[model samples]
Target: MRLRVHTLLFWPHLVAGLLAGLIIGVMSFTGLALAFEHPILERADRETQQVAPPSPGTPRLPVDELIARVRAARPEAQPSAVTEYPDPTRAVTVSTGRTGGVYVNPYTGEVWDWGASGWRAFFHLMEDWHRWLGAQGDNRPVGKAITGASNALFFFLAVTGLYLWWPRKWTWRTLRPSIWFRRGLKGKARDWNWHNVTGFWLLPVLIVLTATGMVISYKGVSDLVFRLAGETPPTAGGPPPGPPIHVPVPPPGSAPLPLEALFVQARKQLPAWENITLRLSGGGAPRGNAPQAGPRPGGNEGKAEARKEGLAPSTFAIRETGGWPLFAATQVFVDPYTAQVLRKDAFADLPAGNRTRRWLRFLHTGEALGLTGQFVAALGCLGGLFLVWTGFCLSWRRFFPAKPGLVSSGDASTSE
Candidate 1:
């Protein structure tokens, strides 16, 4: 009976491992590469990361003047918005139109960088490879479907692999080969032992990674998970209802508060915040409120309803430095004219589902636990690659047994 069960699992595990290993290995390696993207980009652009703090007596350029300078610098480009870093030495990054953006010194309006290029651009490419196999552009559904299916298979493999790694007797002696590296082993024996040891040690992390990858790839599964946690997953229907704060249009000929002043005031409210993305009121939507753009099913209807309810200014997206950027953001809706903060939604104060949704990115990237987590995840990816390579070798050798005495005694016993 025990042998029959092992035989039953062996074929499927072997086949799935062979079939999905290549794609999973690619994903794992790309993910490992992406794990250090932030620090890499920081290092690549270290000089641009911060500028010399201006002389205390000198005032930073006014918001309109900065905008004028960007327009003057790139007259062909339409400046959309600017990201003000809390650090005075950091140049504000400006977004222009759809694809191109430039970083400009607030003190002197000097351009630092532009467009989808550099370490950031390389990571975006790696992200495409990681999630979609780089077969489709911009996360096409077909690519997602393929990656999702492979992730499911990988999850299945992890579970079955765990069962196979379980020693029948559960004795220290019996389990040592699975749990530790064996010296003096050669050929398939060494490969088999290493695969088992690495897989056993990294099993939990691989499981979590594949599980989260599935959640990200499948909408139904994501919804089911949210429901299981007693929360509704965000849908593409409409903007969520926010506090009932009425937005008043500024009087005719009255100027709105300066962008710099609003940020200065917001800084007062959120002292620890590292970055602020302010969308001028009465625009299409606040940057952070809606995750995606381009008309939704009821997008127009939702806008009409928001207009009816006077929730016009959905406000600015401010991010602090405590956790991953996605999870550490707080939406602050200010009275665009007064610079008065009307309402705030901090990450810690979010509902369970929203928080979980925010946390998904960090969990997927293994950055939720910081540098240590990143290192562990990178190692798991490395182990996953090794498992795929070794599993393939072991399977190949098993199908075509080696010459007499070439195979190890322990592996020979398992064959019987």
Candidate 2:
């Protein structure tokens, strides 16, 4: 029965590896490249983003003035958001859209666009391949579907590979070759040794990476995560509804509070904030009170409604030092004219499921646990590449076994 079961799993595993190995290899290589994307981009953009103060004790310009300078330089560009850093040397980033932005020297109010960086482009390309197989436009969903199915297969491979790798006999002699790489091995023997050892050692990390990837790729799995946590799942591309905030709108023709006032309020809200991002509503004057729900502010529909209703609120997202899970932020919504904070969403106050989802998102990239986690995740991706190579080599040898004296002496022990 054990032999029959092993045969059942072994053949399918081999076939799956044969069919999807190349795609999996692409995913692994791209994932490995993206592991250090944040630090790499930061270092690459340091010259563009960092500026020297003209003199000691030079005070940085106000947030509104920095943005004014950006608008003055690039009149065609509409500023949607501005990120201010605590560091005096760091330039203020005014974003027009996701991944499109300009950096302004805070001390000098000089505006400059984020120039083309090869490193940035390379990482973006890697990300495209990783998530969508480099698909563009409407074909991206198809690519995503392909990658998602392969990721599910990878999870299966990791699980069954564990079972096949387990030793029937409890002895170091029985397990040593599979557990550790043996020296002087050749051809089939070398491939088998590498496949077994790499798979055995990386099983845990591979399972984690693939599992988190599933949650990201499939809505069903994501919903299951929330259901399993005893919380209602959020809608696709949106968060679960939170309490509604009643934002008092100023009358039409009344001037909205200055950006500097909102900036000051955000500082007061999160005293230890390392960075603060103020998102502009881009609507003129206030007309009526509009209720805002969810942690995130200003979606397309919300902005449209706000424009029609003539209600504009300033949203501030603040990141503090020593925050749990590294990426969580506190969101504050303020009346554009009254300057009163309508709602404040802190990471600690999030639902358990939401917190879990955030962790899973970061864990997929190994950022949840900081630099050490990223290193381990990168190593796992590298190990996955080796597994695919050796798996293919072993499968090829299995189907076309050596005949009559073609086999090397080292290959004699390669049989399963």
Candidate with maximal TM-score: 2
Off by more than 4 A, model 2 = 54-59, 281-312
lDDT of 1 by residue, 274-298 (tens): 6776543223123223212111111
Tens digit per residue, CA lDDT, model 2, 1-416: 88889999998888888878998999999999999988787777888887875588777787778878877898878777777878877888887755677999988898887864688789889999999999999999999999999998999999999989988897998889899999999989999999999999999999999999999998888888789889887675544555455556667678777778777887888878888876654431222222121123222112334544546456677778887657677777777777787767777776777777767888899988888999999999999999999998888887888787888788878659
The parts of candidate 1 lying over 4 Å away from their true place are 75-81, 96-100, 114-118, 237-245, 249-257, 279-305, 309-311, 321-326, 405-416
Task: List the global CA lDDT of all models.
Answer: 0.69, 0.79
For each candidate in turn, the TM-score is 0.85, 0.91
Task: State candidate 1's TM-score.
Answer: 0.85
Best by lDDT: 2
Please count the clashing residue pairs in each candidate, in the order shown.
0, 0
